[model samples]
Target: MDAQPSGRAMVSRGTDTFCATDGRPATHLPVFDGSLPIMTEQPMVIEDSYTGHVSPGSAPQRRTVPGATITKMSVGPMDNNVYLVVCSATGKSVLIDAANEADRVNQLIGEHAPSLDLIVTTHQHGDHWLALEDVAAATRVDTAAHPLDADALPVRPDRLLDDGDTVTVGEVTLDVIHLAGHTPGSVALALTEAGGGRTHLFTGDSLFPGGVGKTADADKFASLLTDVETKLFDRYGDDTVVYPGHGDDTTLGAERPHLGEWRERGW
Candidate 1:
């Protein structure tokens, strides 16, 4: 894990290259040999964009799919990405990854707090749930995670999501896809619009834009990669929008063609 490049972008001089938040390949981005620089807070504002409404003056984040609106907020020292998945038709929503900063997360909920029905922790990694307990306590909403990772969380999850289980927000239901290796209980959520619209895949730390998530070793990497390819690429088409836990959002189409390249390089 230490081999993973820090989030900051710096001059390149190392073998360990890192991908930019956008979908660019690591070979095309900067490589750093030190820890990611200290993360600085920046003002984030919601503004309408072509893909969706993004937090302008900060990192470009947010995705508006057919039936839901997705928003991202980076928090904590680790720069964990938290997402808000809201159903546009019913306003019912779910908050994914309350990594840290309880007040900031609660504020993101804003007036829609009441419509929030679930607090989903993608996995039990401490960085992914530093503010889980506080946020869950404040929202008074049921928390959910895979049973394998539930025990690792600071707060007990009210709902245990299985591989094929589905959770509903108003009229929309999100299908759960269990993707392990990154963590024993890592999972991705998929949503399809009622009338055959675009599909959205929320991969916690399993899949990313340039490549798959960081694994402890080659075997773990292979397992994560295999799962992603079989369950995601092979199953979903190029149109599926991918909202990863960290960095920027990308689509399956932008990443599908590089599967062989990523596997051979063994990042």
Candidate 2:
């Protein structure tokens, strides 16, 4: 998918990465250590507002959603992909980036898995948090956001999260990581789902379908890119599906092609 400019300020995460920092393009997958804890409920709004539709994204060839599953759903805009991470056995669930469409998000989860228990935010953008109230209204779940971003909330988060912490819902466990570039308070979710069959990451604006988020810190952004390529890419590979802040779903494999160009051009 090609990138489009939304109306709001395009905040750059900076050039802290070695790969795909040019903003050319790369399908990104998050590499994570299952360490951060998840508190379960969360909320955001748009300052640099973007208005568009979310795409269905690449249909997963096969899903573990029904089996040892971690079900994810996209809501808001053109379905900005809100995720429902569920443990098939225990029926415990968490919501990620409900966006401005929490109603749709909850419907999907309530229909598919009934025991949802948490909500999370990847960053402080408006689209990510707007529908959070609706989601909370539907479910009596605890909400969570990074401690750095805890103040951005319209409502106090049930939990204030930081790096390397862990939160559990039934059997599903999620780890939180703070990559503060998108908003000085943005964070990402790294979780081991389905009894740790594999690891998954819900990177907010930190990384996108084909590129990392935009920020003012070019050097730091470049290093973040490097961390993705050398560290995250090397570990996660192209197979891992990286659920991003906006746009289509991507795999590290799809993103690998754009790395060199991003690094050289230096966005």
lDDT digits (tens) for residues 52-164 of candidate 2: 22344322111363223544444444546666666767877777876754444554655555677778877676767777766665566789988777776655689878877
Q: In model 1, what are the clashing residue pairs, if there are any? A: none
What's model 1's TM-score?
Answer: 0.78
Worst lDDT run of 10 residues, candidate 2, spans 3-12
Provide the clash count, candidate 2. Answer: 58
Compared with the true structure, what per-residue lDDT tens digits does model 1 show for residues 1-267?
111211222221224433325545566656666788734333345444634323312443556767777777776665667888888889999988887666567667753334889999998777788777777766678999999999988789999998989989987789999997898889999988668777888899899879998888889888889999998998887998887877667899999989999999895
lDDT, each prediction = 0.76, 0.61
Off by over 4 Å in 1: 1-45, 50-62
Report lDDT (Cα) of residue 130, candidate 2: 72
